[model samples]
Target chain A: MTDISQSAAVPGTAPQRPAATLSARLARWLPRLVMAPSFLVVLIGVYLFIAWTLWISLSSSAMLPRYDFVGLEQYVRLWNTPRWHTAVINLFLFTGLFLAVTIALGLLMAILLDQNIRAEGVLRTVYLYPMALSFIVTGTAWKWVLNPELGVEKVVQSWGWDTFAFDWITRPETAIYCVVIAAVWQSTGFAMAIFLAGLRGIDSSIIKAAQIEGASLPRIYASIIVPLLRPAFLSVIVLLSYISIKSFDLVLALTNAGPGGSTEMPSTFMFAYTFQRNQMGVGAASAIMMLMTVAAIIIPYLYSELREDTHGH
Target chain B: MATLDINRVRKAYGNLEVLKEVNISVGDGEFLVLLGPSGCGKSTLLNIIAGLEDITGGEVLIGNRVVNDLPPKDRDIAMVFQSYALYPTMTVRQNIEFGMKIRGIPAEERAKATNAAAEMLQMTGLLDRKPSQLSGGQRQRVAMGRAIVRHPDLFLFDEPLSNLDAKLRVDMRTEIKRLHQRLGTTIVYVTHDQIEAMTLATKVAVMKGGVVQHFGPPQEVYDRPANTYVARFVGSPAMNIIPGWLLASDGVPTVAFDTPQGEAVVRGVPLSAETAHRFAGRDVLVGIRPEHFGLDPSGTVPVGVDVVEPTGPDTLIVFAAGGTEVVARLEPFDAQVGRQERFSVKAEKVVLFDPATETRLD
Candidate 1:
């Protein structure tokens, strides 16, 4: 109360009043100002690099940077390349398989854990621990396990089952599915954790009301529980799709875009052109295309979810 | 068409007993209310009858069929919980039709039942709206409609009006009573509100410490309580219990005590020899309802009024008499604060209980 009086008196007549207001303004703005330098530095670097890539793409840049300009010639060359088309087709194959498997596996795991089973804590830790590991580690572990000669095939031969052949990692047609399996194993745990929290947030009284009405458990879950979990499912789908589109390290570590580039995703293609082949122009174009694709898919879904949340309440 | 009987029901949690040997039999088409204060095990007893809770040692018979082993679904009882428990995802129509739909009722009949219930509850226009979209009183009506639509063997209400505001609670209480009257269904209702118990209950069972202290018609339980607990619990402004001494002198029984101004006498019959042996010439408690005390300044009972609470209908005067703080409900125009007023109580209206046992002497 005394402080209120003193502050009112001080603000009423003082030369330092303007300075005090100034200090308050500076206090609010200082963090953004301090954080601007690092971000601004990255922004400038990216601008120069992108301009340089655009300039080189117009020219016949080979293995190193060139400054000659030839409009749309390199774009025409990129369109004609069969490997570029293969990479685009393979991108969809890898992402589609990864998304489907991860969502299915996550929902199944979430439902199992929702049951009143014993040792739930232990089971949850086991399932969610995979999310903490890097996809590089997961992919490498699966790659070795699925390798024909060194791992599965050799082990099966030692067990006297020489006819058993496990060679998906060595074949171009079947290798995309192998990468999908590893990616699902890595991301399903994360999606399950998101869904598990949503399941727990549902009111227990609603479930009891269903039971008291003589509804069988499955019918109640199918008709009531699933519909209530729609918002949660939307969030899970959006998060997993983002992860699937940007899947680079897992594909690189598992198949290395090898066995004839069967598992080549967009991010992996961007990295290969930028670092391996020094085709940074094509790589930067692919990066911008990937960003646009994600925005186009995610923004509408997020906007609808937000509108429903606000208006429904 | 069903008469529910609870036979010697006892409930315990490990070492702590929650309800003790509770026996109540509700007749066909009777509205039996389990009335008590909070934590008095009234809700627990209701839960047992609804088959929502397992009775520790007892049998519950619904229409002569022992149903203690049945689940809540199999018991043919519908309970409207205190929280309403309306599924937030379901519309008002679906919530009412849920039980019928689950029982394989035809859609045409379900719609007919739902429309009839909605019309009866005056909730016709709000059928498609979810529970979250409805007001508190509307949601409460939906919960009741869910129970009424079932036409179950018995209706169980667990303090269903406790969550509503004061005015809405009163209105809904009357509505539920009217619904019961029209349907003539046997219902077991639970509430801590003595006013609701007195107004709506065909029979009242007053419980305390998990034991049924008294069970009878509401007026009978209020006017003639079986023990000190029931007498004090069944009335608003609570009964005034004063410490006194029992006297059985010269073949006549009476209670004698001293007030701040003078000594007083109360007329009553002492309990049996085995009951009187423990309380003869010993300190006892005399219970008198607040309304029983009236102004008769020259009638011998003298007390100084300490506080006066005027609530339109009656005035509650807190006074000291017989070495105990007593509250008397007096005519609003006659009572005043901070004055020595003489009050007279009828001898026939007083209830005497032995202090050692708390059981009514006469």
Candidate 2:
């Protein structure tokens, strides 16, 4: 009887050992298995494409992508083009104005909404409604409104203000400003939402304390409240910079790089060169330059933010 | 320093009245504490005095000036918030000097005042650090330093020590008391902590449900609480209120109650002659502090000890007495559980209250 029982137990224990090890192995591999598809997709779709673009920027790839090494010739050509110069300068101008006006107007709106006001929810929704629309939609809607004969100028003239002259879109020197206006209108509400969240996170007693300290309301906001919103300001700037760089759709729909190419941006210039003008080499070079500019701004921010997280601060 | 007077101040939010004609007065350099549980309108009253909230009715006077229409800045008061609301982006030095700078004081004077306040708070080393760099107690000191630099006529503290850890809270309490002694500024402080009120206030206003239940010196509020609510709310291991009969025979007032061991009577309960005569043979609530019960072998009351909790300073023994469980705070090892022990009530300290009104009998 003892011999029979021992024999049966040995087979049972042998099978159980392998089954346990198999299940443990499956458990360890399951998460990686589930994540592998997305990981591979991103690796190929983003990083691989970036590397290909870098290679093409360094090569003499024209309309057909001929892979012949032509070390910086496309870059030289890109710099010499006056249209590219206009695109670059326009980018800087649009980015600066868009950031400044959007932040100022957004912060103002957030502060006004924070005064324990009635109907705040409805007002907030009204301000934020534009952000839900696509930039193309915003651009098209603004295009109609900015047209001198069809929109604001005509309406004002119809209302008997015949010399209103609100036609910046028609002037080459001021056309970029019109793009800046449309872009600011599209993004200011997003910045306001971020600022509102940051404002809500503050200890309300600080304002009360400042009030008791004999500081005027404007002084309190300028010195104490705004200074405390440094992190919020950094977040807003980074997000707005990202938005300004990739603002191809809005510019395309609103100005289409029109009025002597005054409102042309890097993104628009790159698209016109590569796809329309058959200068893919110069387009690739411009794309690389745009990437470098963004990296210059974002890398340092990401490094500091990640370092703060690691230090548990 | 200045006197603060709130006369018939009423605060209402639409139809819900938070403060109902509340009145309080504090003399120059006096520390007054508004003590109550949350939603008791103590903090609201403090805000009304600070001009941080609008008064639905009545008047608030500071230094004999009616500040009904004055903003908080013109009220000539400085406040310390419970969260120690130091400007997070500013250094301690800058925070202390900000008010002076806003008032357009000379730079030299601002620096001098900042340095003096920092040194007085013993945080000179921390003057260059932002609020996030400091610990809770250090932040509290910085908040006080900011208030101190103003040198306002009055100070308001809205539960300033409620955020600290237990040990740090005790330490900061002492620090605040020391500052008050050194500065001698009239202060109106709000807190839900009875111990804080007892230790720090010259006068304490114990509030409940928007009414001032008792307003007097700390000892008076402790010894002679105005009502049963004040009695129960003012003490830890709150005063035991047992139901019993007030027997007045031959002009001597005694209390009679039923215990598990049978009848128990406490003789010579001190009361006014009229109160004793009128409440004779009527139901009354006997208010007895935990420490008033003593272990005596020949005492009249017998209680069956149910639980023994030996704290470091004294042991708390819960027993069945007067048809309810009563806790007696006594020296450690005074009695054992599951034993019948006789305890005596301190006659003079014992108080009687009418059962219906819950008010002290004389």
Candidate 3:
């Protein structure tokens, strides 16, 4: 310790120390200095805004910021509104169906493409093409495709199937299902890419050993391969949940929560109350509710994942 | 246990042929090692025998039944891979009983077989542990346990010990040999390590360039290699191939080669009468093993020692003979470099090969 302190003290009194220490200090502070702007921007933009929203959720702010506190009243009003109830129900329905169908279709495609198929690059590109577009683009494209007069119904009727009536997007009860279909189509390829990477990470000789052990292809995949893809499943679920909760642009471009406001989600509902309906306090409460739901699911997953990492697994 | 017969097997991918008309036969309960360097078609042949790869133009018989169109599961064979290939998610017991479960065997029978295999491999305490939790040697034992629980007609091992460290490889090699002796099942093992082939194999097939060069007992293959490639491949500090002339002196067949000191002749070479007669006064290649040279002050061959290396048990002296470097493993002797010495060659142990064809003359 004395030797280290001596060397450290010598550098301060040396004749050529100014030039050397200037370079050394520059080297030490350069990375932090370069990162400071973005760090400060995120500190204000994301975290400060979150704190502000939480405080506003406890206050009675309608058209502007108000400091007068009203504890839990906005939450009470948020739960009592019928449209908020519909939005909550629709959110759960969309999240559950979106998760199930995307995972199933994605894993199926990844497994099928893993069979040493021909033109696999072309097929993978085609499947992943939807993820390259913005949610607005996908929503608009799927809106036209689900439209009865312009898309599938008209195409089928042009082929002389005139008695067919395909109009799910026009009905309030079935409009959410249409939104679910469009969202699944947009993100299933992303899930497949992740699953494909996981599948490729497995040792090929395990499959060979399973084959030699008299396990059929499907049995091997179901029993051995799927269980090994737990990490991939976690990743897909977390990312898709985030997408489902923040589903604002897609709803606007596709259904606009129309046909009796049946397909309203928390994101669209939050936007309408804060900007259009002048109920900022209730809007902040709903946003906090969404944040809590996300935290509830993600905290345990992150805890386990980080605990595994620290244990050197 | 059953005999394995690979009859005229050939493997080709498009225009590139990897295995060319290979033929080998293993008796029941015999340990046959297919030994070769990388890309030498040994593993390909083993895969063909396991029905993992298709035979281009030949038949493979297990227990005298031709299984050309059978899948790997239909063939009653179990294989242990070099990577161990254990199911990472499953416990050791589950891995061992997977085959039995797929075959619809009873739970009691599966558990009994799994316990028996684990006990035999001395891994009873590891039955509930995942493969990721086991060490390399333990994982290898689990792989072997999985293979043996099936009680198949044959066992195939694809360089199973190559992934192990040297000391662990030897231990696992001994374990495999003990397993073979207790089971008495036909085994076809493929490896590139000559020592493993020498220690554990009942018969060895040394291959190169997709062709089997020599096939016999390990002792026979080592004593009388069929070609120059086999001579250089199967031994450490490989056999010396010296240019020499084959001729007879006083009705005794002899080999004469030039040394750095002088010309030397090794008499009484044990060649057949036909070989002696056919190769008289012709140039030939002489193969002498490093251990076949004995130091003698009054010996016939004079060598100028260039370098000396004393291993623990034997001293290796590198010398110039027949215009090429030669190594002779000798007993610990006080030999100085850059000094002229005389050494006697074992005449009967000397092998002669044809220079044109590179095959043994006799």
Candidate 4:
């Protein structure tokens, strides 16, 4: 690549090496050459888009890009909007309940499955099947199941008890709770699998020793097994937080910020204002807010995990 | 201390019988070592005593109470596992105090017991450190410390030193022996290492194929094994078993087998009256310990040496005898490979077994 200008300018300053030497020199860049495509893609696709959104949030953009700087005006407007306020509140409500309920249900299932049960393989596969479904599918399925007329309420009424009402999907105040239920159902199995692996990796002799030491089953798990599962718990929490922060598809498919924006989340708000509502600046600001939330939860966890990996446990 | 009685304890997993009619009982303060190779049901027998496995057709009595239906926790025992089994999340102090705490002992008492155990194990500095931070030998001490603080009636050790290095294993073995000496608690230790069994057990039960072949003091088991299997299992450089002919010479019994040199006769074996009468004209298997062979230059049992293994204390002379390889422990300076060595087998120590049944010909 440096063939023409360097040799012409230097005349005889540049020594011409043998073909073997040339190939050896080219071998030095072989690894970097092979790694370039993926590196370039990530640099453009992830960071470039991130930088573009950051700039858009700082500018006076409506449907398209504008050069005039607006400085945090879009953020102030987002804060003042009632629907955006509902979205942020719902995000916390969903994230908190989703995490708590999922971890609890997942741990219960993992402990049950760890009991050397018959048909454990089939039961594990059934429990884990929901994690294989996309959020779109889970959201759509739960929407129907929670429907007052077509699903659970109608079925319960048909079996008598005609006053049955399971319509959390339709109420403005309770709509966010329905989203939490569906999200937890879709993610609990993921947590369960990780927890189960952690449980299996423990030396079973520890349990035997505890039993011989006159510790009951519950006491053993409380004092020893569960505490040893800290790494699994941390990983599951971080992954669920990431999922909750970027959770646009599930909300869009199930509630669509529905019941007059009572169930709207930050992800849904960012999507609506960015693509459909012609307010790019507000959308970009909401997106940045969501990014900061994810980074807040994830960066320290990643730092601890990486640092532990380097230092070794 | 408690007496552990396994009365006809039979363990089976859905028709594959792991243990069959295993009957053994240890007196209070007896250190019983269950010695056997793998898959011999030695571990199953130990587990049966610990109430870890269900007894299919027998009763296990701990201090005269039938504990067949009792869970391991109610059996009033502490087990040191092969893997150390220390709760990885707990510190040394917590690990030691776990049993006492679970038993609802007062916090002060639990702390006192934990401190006592840590001091006893010389692990006072390691009380706050987790098991993962400890070395293997330290982990073993922590496991034993956990057992010690329990003050359980019986202590069960399931090959607790198998994971250590050779040098460490020896050190830990001595430490376990010393611990046993200090406490004198009734301990049932399981190991495949014959040396460990011989050195530690007041009563060693040599098991093979789910049957106790021999049960006695370590020296008695080594000197007078009940069967060919016991004879082969207990001694280091296992007892050399040679198939031979039995004949009586002036009331003292003698066994004759073919060596590379010719037919060699080992006499002066004192056989019981029944054995002498029954095996007078039958084939007898001679059991001779490797260490019992004396390096006599004018010895009658001549054999061609193949290899010399000097193990610091004694040289093991490997020789081709009859149709099988036999090893004799001789002085390091007296043994050399590729040369014939005449060694005298101690006749009184030469026990005989009936080849048809492999039972001792007493």
Q: What is the TM-score of chain A in candidate 2?
A: 0.93
Write one digit per residue (lDDT tens) for candidate 4, span A29-107: 8989999999999999999999999999999899998877989999999899898998888888899999999999999
Stretches of candidate 1 above 4 Å error?
Answer: A1-101, A149-165, A308-312, B10-20, B37-40, B249-253, B256-264, B268-280, B321-324, B334-337
Give TM-scores for every candidate, taking all chains together and pairing residue i with residue i.
Answer: 0.87, 0.96, 0.97, 0.95
Instruction: Kindly report the fnat of each predicted structure, to 2 decimals.
Output: 0.49, 0.85, 0.78, 0.95
Q: In candidate 4 chain B, what residue range of length 10 has the lowest lDDT sum?
A: B332-341
Residue B242 alpha-carbon offset, candidate 1, angstroms: 2.6
Model 3: residues with Cα > 4 Å off, grouped in runs: A1-18
Clashes of each: 0, 0, 0, 0
lDDT per residue (tens digit) for residues B239-301 in model 4: 989888887566678788888788788878869876787778678888888888888888879
Cand. 4: chain B TM-score: 0.96
Q: Looking at model 4 chain A, report the run of 10 residues with the lowest lDDT sum.
A: A12-21
Order the candidates by lDDT, highest first — what do you get? Answer: 3, 2, 4, 1
For all the predictions, what are the DockQ values? Answer: 0.50, 0.80, 0.82, 0.76
Return the clash pairs for model 4, or none. none
Q: lDDT per residue, candidate 3, A1-313, as tens digits?
A: 9999678878557777788789999999999999999999999999999999999999999978798899999999999999999999999999999999999999999999999999999999999999999989989999999999999999999999998888999999999999999999999999999999999999988988999999999999988999999999999999899899989999999999887899999999999999999999999999999999988888988998999999998
Error of 3 at A286 (Å): 0.9
Worst 10 residues of 3 chain B by lDDT: B247-256
> Each prediction's Cα lDDT score?
0.83, 0.91, 0.94, 0.89
